[model samples]
Target: MPPTDGTPSDTDVRASTGKKRIPKACNPCRHSKVKCDEQRPSCTRCQTLKKTCIYVEKPKTAEEQKIEDLEQEVLVLRQQLQTQRDTESSIVVSQPQRLMGQRPPEITSPDSNASLNHSSPTWTSDKPLKRKRSHFRMQKEVAVPDFINEGILSEPQALHYFNSFFEGCDRYVPIFDGSDGFAAVRLRSSLLLNAICAVGCGISGDASVDSRILHVRLKRWLTTVILSTHAQSLETVQALLVMACWMPERSLILAIATRMAVELQLDDAFDRLVNLSISRPDTPETHILMKSARTWFLLLNLEQILQVDAGNLVDLRIKGVRRCRTLLNRPFSSRLDARLFSQVELNRLRAKVNETLTSHSDDLLQAVQEARVDIDVWYQDWKRIMEASPLSESELPSLIANLTVQRHWAEAMAACRAVRATGVHQVEMMSPEAHDMLVIAKEALQNHLYVMLSQPHYLANFRYAMDFVWAKCAFSFLLLLKLTILLPDVARQDLLGQGRALLNELTKSSGYGSSKVYLRLLQLTIKKYASRDQTHSGELDAFIPEEFIFEWDFPGLNLFSSPTGWDMLFDQYMIGDDLFVGMDI
Candidate 1:
């Protein structure tokens, strides 16, 4: 948000160095060489003198200004495309009068459902269907107007969703760097814009667009566009990766996405970016190249997770990638690059743990110990870097710190599962390793919740809130659910109470779409078993947490392995294709 400085601002706040936080001076103060009490609509001197106060407007972040520019460009392009279609078809289209002058609804999109009203402009469809009149025959035709509603919705709803995503999610994941800022750049960039709209719609938690139907249409369109495209582009790969996060629950889409990423040489792009970083300064090309690393690393991270869950080999091989080794060691040019570099390193640690546990059971214990040390070192280094930078001023620093804590927790859980899977019959409930693992999970959940609650401001931004919040909620619930069964009655009740509070917070209060339904599903799952005597009997069989960490897909979560299924509930949402099942993993 650019600050308006027509007057003095809040000059009271000062940094530790005694520098005024509001440094911008009024024009009168600047000319008189007097210290201006950077105030609001007017400064103290301006108020006293009855003179006009003019302050320099604070510059907007490149990410924001750029997106706004792109949005404008997209709008222009849409209008031109509309005109072109009309010209080609030899028919001019006219918009309805009601829509021409009406103000669009305010759109606020986040990755998950938080800080959102239960209803949004996106949820309600007020437009009447239009029938296309044929030239020769009086045939009626209804087009798929819904296809680009997000793109062309009068208030530019897609712009809101797009900006919201960059604000909340892209900072954590830098797929959309401002290097490609112009509307022209966006226009030429294949499915990038459309894919962004798709993810925005998915995470916005708006029910206005039929997600199930749009999911199919978007996937089909994405596939069709990519297949016919003769060129591979960073935008296409970036979009596919975004969808991997947006629609993660779909295994087949991920498989196909993995293939698309490979075909686009995302890894090779990472390699090129690494060399470019060392060979050149932070020029335009280098900046873009670095962003491609973020895209590639994200793909590797998701692919690794899916592979671990499926017990298949993730096709990406980063170890041999020359840039993989040097990218982290080099000085980061931007916050996005630094954050992405940290994620790549973290995912590498995860992949190591998963690969060892699955491929070499004989070495699981040894490997887990080593991986723990590696992750700790990585976390410490990244923590230091984060503290050293301006990121400390933002929620990202702690948000990621909590994520790191959670990742370690997932590692502990996987280690516990590995111990059991590796025929550790000697390990009893009272065994030190088992107890240690349980405590680790408990501590992780506590710290994760602490971080989340500590930063209410971050969670308040519903647009980007969904992914991180959703992941945290899902992971915490499962951990607490597991602990509910594992702990003694008093301790179990305490954990259960917390779990209930968490569910109630989202289900009863949160107004975002799907949150109530999702939380209710969790509550019912707990209810179905919370009362059974067998549940509190220290039965370990009832507590298999999803081993794959960092999974928050709407279609994925499954509870109650008790023959009864939650498929009926989930079937209401979630859409995907299954043609890529046999793809090489």
Candidate 2:
């Protein structure tokens, strides 16, 4: 009954093991170590362990042991090479420099050459050092172009050629210490001549061929030399900026030059030059250049708004608005001072700019908008003062009020638009102030509207109060809807409604409208109730507020009594109502 499945047992296994014999060698050799297999020059055992494998007698002395060690090292290295060959392809080894018979130069003192004569042992005496004739032979010399060269046919051509003439002289200019004024003056005259030529060509429309050439020459001179050398002087920088402004591609040039002037603390000089140009009566070029400067200034100011730390944003906004006002008020008339105005017609043209301040209110609005502060109250107060002032026009206050409302509406719209523009792509979206405002506004309006629409008992009363409580909401909603249509497909959902359609038709017919607060409210309501359960109250409970179930509207009282009241209602209906509903009452 030994093992039912097999015949062989432990006795047979023991008899087989008793017949095996152990090898009389080192454990490594008996285990068939890879190193022990190396039998040529050295045994694999010694080679694997990196030990000397002397086939003959072992070394008797230290010196002999050292020699044996070196031999073993060589053998091990050769074995390594063989192993590497088995694993990887062989690489071509470069011959050593020593084997090529080339000796590298020795380090010597520089003065050693001067002290050692050709006859000395350290020197090569075989050849007498022929007096080392100057190795500083001039290569091909480039001729400098003369400003008044006879070879050049026209004064413009001569000036154009001379612009590059001083280019080589840049190396000699003491740019760091300060420019050599005399040298700069000569250079300036040459450049100025070229600029004058280009202007002349532009004026005559005949020098068109050389005008571009002159412009390039002048630009190179200003950017490379004049601006670089005399950058300390705002006047010089302004002049360069002015010159660059004359070219078709002026914005980039003006930006660079203005930034340079700003960095150099020559803002006053820059402003002065701009003011002079703007104030110039006779020069159209100067007037246009001033506008370019103003644009640059606006850009700088806009950049500063982003960097604003702790300051009254209201004050900053007022300052910005005032600055724009001042710019608009600056006389553009050519009739008064010919130096201040470009021409008689331009001075006559200046009469039209009395209304420029009104148009520039957009710029003021833009600045205020960027500040992200509430200016509605301030704007209202200012409007009153502006209306009462003899200098202010009758339409100005209404215009300002309209702009202020638009600004607020735009801010809210920007938030909603941002969500569609950004987040829908499965990426993390930055929740900006605008986005938060829209979210709060939308949610509040939506929640309130859903309550109002869902309650059948309040529908009659709601309609009665809708005209007063929801007018503002209706106006804002309409405005928002109009803006939403301008947005891409993804954000159009936020602008949905019958109110929007009604307003659209109205706007088309009457050519005027109010805000879209009400429209957004209606959309929010639809969004809320559309998801509710018609069969059960469970889903509806989540959207409809608990307070909405109770009859809370008080006639002739504040319509915004509901916790989620007319603010939400007006956002949707553009009307204010005096219906008060208290939880306790």
Query: Considering every candidate listed, which one attains the maximal lDDT?
Result: 1
lDDT of every model, 2 decimals:
0.51, 0.34
How many clashing residue pairs are found in candidate 2?
53
User: In model 1, what lDDT does residue 44 have?
Assistant: 92
Query: Across residues 241-304, which tens digit of lDDT does each residue of candidate 2 receive?
Result: 4354245343455456556545443333234444554546435433433333343343343222
Candidate 2: residue 433 Cα off by (Å): 12
lDDT of 1 by residue, 1-585 (tens): 223443343442222124434347776786677998889899999999888887655556789999999899767755664454345334321112111111223223232121221112123223445768667752232222333444543336656556545655565446555444425334545356556665566556666764555556667666454454332455656666666565644456566656655654445556566555666755555555556566777777666655544444545657753245355434444445556666666655666666576677665556666766776777777676666666334545554655465465555545555555454332243356545555554565565554545554434443343343454465566655554344434565555565565554554334333343344445654554455454223333332223222333211122222323322222222342332233321
The C-alpha TM-scores of every prediction are: 0.58, 0.24
Worst 10 residues of 1 by lDDT: 93-102
Native RMSD of candidate 1 (Å): 28.8
How well does candidate 2 match the true structure in TM-score terms? 0.24
